[model samples]
Target: MDVVTRCVHRESSVEEIMIYTGKSKSYVKSAISAAILLGMIEQLNGDIYKISDDCYGILNTTPSEELKTSLFKSRIEKWEPFILYLKYLISGESSVVAIRKLCSLYSFNRTPVQIENLLKNWAKSTGILDATGEIVDINLSYDENEILYKLNEETVNDTNVSLFMINILGENIFSWLYHDEIAELKKAILIFRDHPRDAIQCSGRAFEDVLRRISIQSGVDTRKLNGITQVANNLYSQLDSTDNPFIHSKLKNIASAIGDIRNMAGHGKEAKSMERWELSSTSAIAHLLLTLSTIKGIYSYVNENRYDF
Candidate 1:
């Protein structure tokens, strides 16, 4: 069925199958027989066959071909708790303590022992644990508790960077971005620590995208602005001219530093650019700018409510 769907759309001839599938006539005949046996194809006439509706829908779905095939294979193998536990794993929430807490919160009428058993089943099925419910030979490291898998160096770095972002940008910043912007931000954070250069470029682009939107909202004709830097400068100029000169100077310095580092890293002008310090500092400044420019109320709220909180 897969072979047929690879080349055949609505209908295909046996001769065409031989050509496209790069198979002999006998091989094609055997594959057709296997498809028919599996109820994936129905014989319409002498040589013409139609793929089953279920099979066709599976093959032509939203997910990628590889994912679709894996899902289909797993359907035959039949994994229990199909997706819920898998989502929990992918959320990077693997600590036994966290799991127990979640079970307590959500798993109604199920004892902790039963929840642990389910986790073991899921872990074993996913190859993270062996048949004996022990950690497998996957690259994951572990702590003394033997519950949560400790992230390796690259993953740890990425997590730290993303944590910093969460602290500065606030966890709910996604509420302000469009769907595509949220996707871009997620991709940036996913690779930032491991691949700072690419992440910096992505961050710079996001900064510009967000700044443009904010500029538009501020009643500024952003279409007249030359670029993001100009827009930023104009907004900064508007921020309380009677305010303390020292604060304005510091803000200018941070903005300049962020823009310089972003440009150097993004354009690939210098080798070994955007070292750890530069990346972290620029990220901090950019986050501040993003908050102040786009979600200014958040900054105001944090400052005014800091002691209250």
Candidate 2:
């Protein structure tokens, strides 16, 4: 689509497409066919083509309900029991027993190897699961073997941490994050969920990355800001002066708390007054901040709908 977009107002010949996309002639033909099917581009004046107006909006926005449903049906609807078994494993279920039970529930009448093979492909090929069975883009991990399957200690200890990770897996959450930031954020989330004592520091580090990205987008000079507190102060000052002060204040407070916890972690100190629940909640707030930053880019969509973020 990007190549086609570039070719708009000119001829989109297969030869030119091959040069632009660096793909085979067959691949170019297939892409053009799919684009036409989806109404993303249309042939014009016999040989020339152009991107459709609707394609621009569709490319930039979240997937439509029909597209989401079609994707679910193709990639996940039949594999739901496999996901269920993985969730059940978090409760300490045995893999051998779980596989048999899953097969029975689905009435597949297949052997355990077949089930494992099916899920293994899904795990390895798709972003749904990592090589170690960790849910991709979330803070959950799992281990599996011929005899058993179990949730990783980090996941089992703090189930609440998975709430946002699970929900955002297929929701286009990464559209907000840059390519390099995605890996760093994923690593931070794994540590945040798995290590309670280190949660604050992990989230604080992740929040710093979030702010850095926002600085690039909003044209703020992050290099002048020494830390999260300074960054927050500068950002609030730049926001609309007529906006609700109370809402902005809460955001500033959250940023301050992130920096404070990070300092405590740095000094090897513990806050006796704070509990795991509070740390967990802080992580949730960090996740919300990341989501809200992305939401801000699509102001038109936000104005058309109500979003708690």
Judging by lDDT against the true structure, name the best candidate: 2
lDDT tens digits, residue span 1-309, model 1: 354474237666677667767899988987776466445667776787776776776665244666545434333222222223333343455646435645543533456666666556545654655786455524332221221122224433222333333334443443345434544554555554456566666656666676667555544456777544665676565533244221133344444554565676656435566343445533633443443343334232323322111
How many clashes would you count in candidate 1?
A: 0
Estimate the TM-score of every prediction.
0.39, 0.38
Task: Note the Cα lDDT for every prediction shown.
Answer: 0.49, 0.50
Candidate 1's C-alpha runs over 4 A off are 1-168, 239-253, 268-309
- For model 2 the local lDDT of residue 307 reads 33
Please give the lDDT score for candidate 2: 0.50
What RMSD, rounded to one decimal, does every model reach?
Answer: 13.6, 16.0
Candidate 1 TM-score over all chains jointly: 0.39
Spell out the clash pairs found in candidate 1: none
